[model samples]
Target: MPVAVVLPGALNPLAGCVPPFDRCGARARHATGPWASSQGTQILENGDAVDLTWVESAGAPVIVKEESLRNLWGGYVNSDYENACEVDGYAGLVTFGEPTATVTGLVINEIPAPTAFMEEYRSIVQWISSSSDARFVEMVREGIASVSMWDEGPIVRVNGPLAIFDAALPGTEAGADELLLVEIESDTPAPARESIGWIP
Candidate 1:
C-alpha cells in the first residue's frame, strides 16, 4: 500500500518490508551487511507488495541498520537523487522535486542512524558546493520535503527534519539585505531512523 503523504506523524510505511528472518539467518553470507541484500524479498517505495527477487548490483553496507539494497528499484531511485540535508537526527533525500511520489527504492530510513551514516552528506552538501545563501535555503527545504535520510543513490547519505529547517530559512529578506546563510546541522547523535507506495 502507498504510504499516505500526510505528515505530522505517520506510521512507518516500511515496517514489514524486510522479514525478521532476513535480519539474522543463513542469508547473512550473501549480503554485504545486515539489510542491503541482493536477494530475498523487498518492498519498493511505490507501494508494491513485498516479494522475492534476485539480482546483482553494487550496494553500500548501511552500518547503522546493517542492510543492503541491490534491487532494480535501488538503482532507479538512486538515479533521481541529487542531494540531501540533515538537522539533529532528521534528514531527507532531495531529488530536485522529481516525481518520486511512489517509486521503488531503498527503505526511507526507520530511525535516525544511531551508528555511522553517509560520511559526506550534510544539510548544505550539493553536487557543486555553493556559497550562496539562497542555495543553502533551497537545500534545506529539499531535505524537509522528502523527510528523512537514506543512501540517496549508493554513495551519499541524506539528512533533515524539514519543517524545522524550512521554517528557519528566511523567506522575506531575499531581494533586500546582504543575505548570508552561515551554517547547517551536522554530525549529531544518530537517533536511529525511521518510510512506502504505487501504480502503473
Candidate 2:
C-alpha cells in the first residue's frame, strides 16, 4: 500500500483529507479494474479496473487544471544613501542598508484565470513588502522576475500572459502561496489562461 499526503484547502479540508489506508484502498480500487483476489495485491481484487501501477502504466494524462497553478517570488532589497564630502576626496559617500531576501512567484501551472487571483495575491505581496519584523521587502522587490503558466507536453510551453510586478509592496512574500491558492478556488472551473498583470 502506497502512502500519499494530500493538503486540502481551508474551506474543505475534509474532502482533501484521506487516510493512508483509505488512500491505498482507493488506489487499489482504481487499479486492477475489478478482477483480482486480495485488496492489497498489485493486481487488485477487482479485475474490472486497473491497478495504481496499471494507471501509471497506461500513462493517463494528469491534466493540471486551471486551479492548480502555483505562484512564487524570489529576491532581495537594499537601501542606498549618498552624502557630500568636505576636503579633497571623492565627490560623495554612499551608504547601503542590510540586504533583505524574499520569495515571489505565481504558480500558474493549473490556474484557469490568474488575473482574478491578483487581489489576494497582492495583499500578501504588499504585506511582505512592508513587513518591518521580517525585513523581507528588499527581496520581494527584486526577487520576482515574472509569473507564467506552463502546460505539460512534449515541450512544456507557457500557457498564458506573463504577470510582472511594477512596484514592491509590504508584507507580500510571507503569505504569497496561501493567498494564490485561495484565489484559485474562488470560482468554478474554467479554461486556463495567462494573466497580464494584477491591478489590485
Which 10-residue window of candidate 2 scores lowest in summed lDDT? 81-90
TM-score of 2: 0.15
Q: Candidate 2 lDDT, tens digit per residue, 15-117? A: 2211212323221112222211212223213332221111110111111111222222211121110010111110111222234532122221111111111
Which structure among the candidates has the greatest TM-score? 1
User: Global CA lDDT of candidate 1, please?
Assistant: 0.23
Clashes of 1: 28
lDDT (Cα atoms) of all candidates against the true structure? 0.23, 0.20
Listed in order, each prediction's TM-score against the native is 0.18, 0.15
lDDT of 1 at 158: 23
| Per-structure clash totals for the candidates | 28, 62
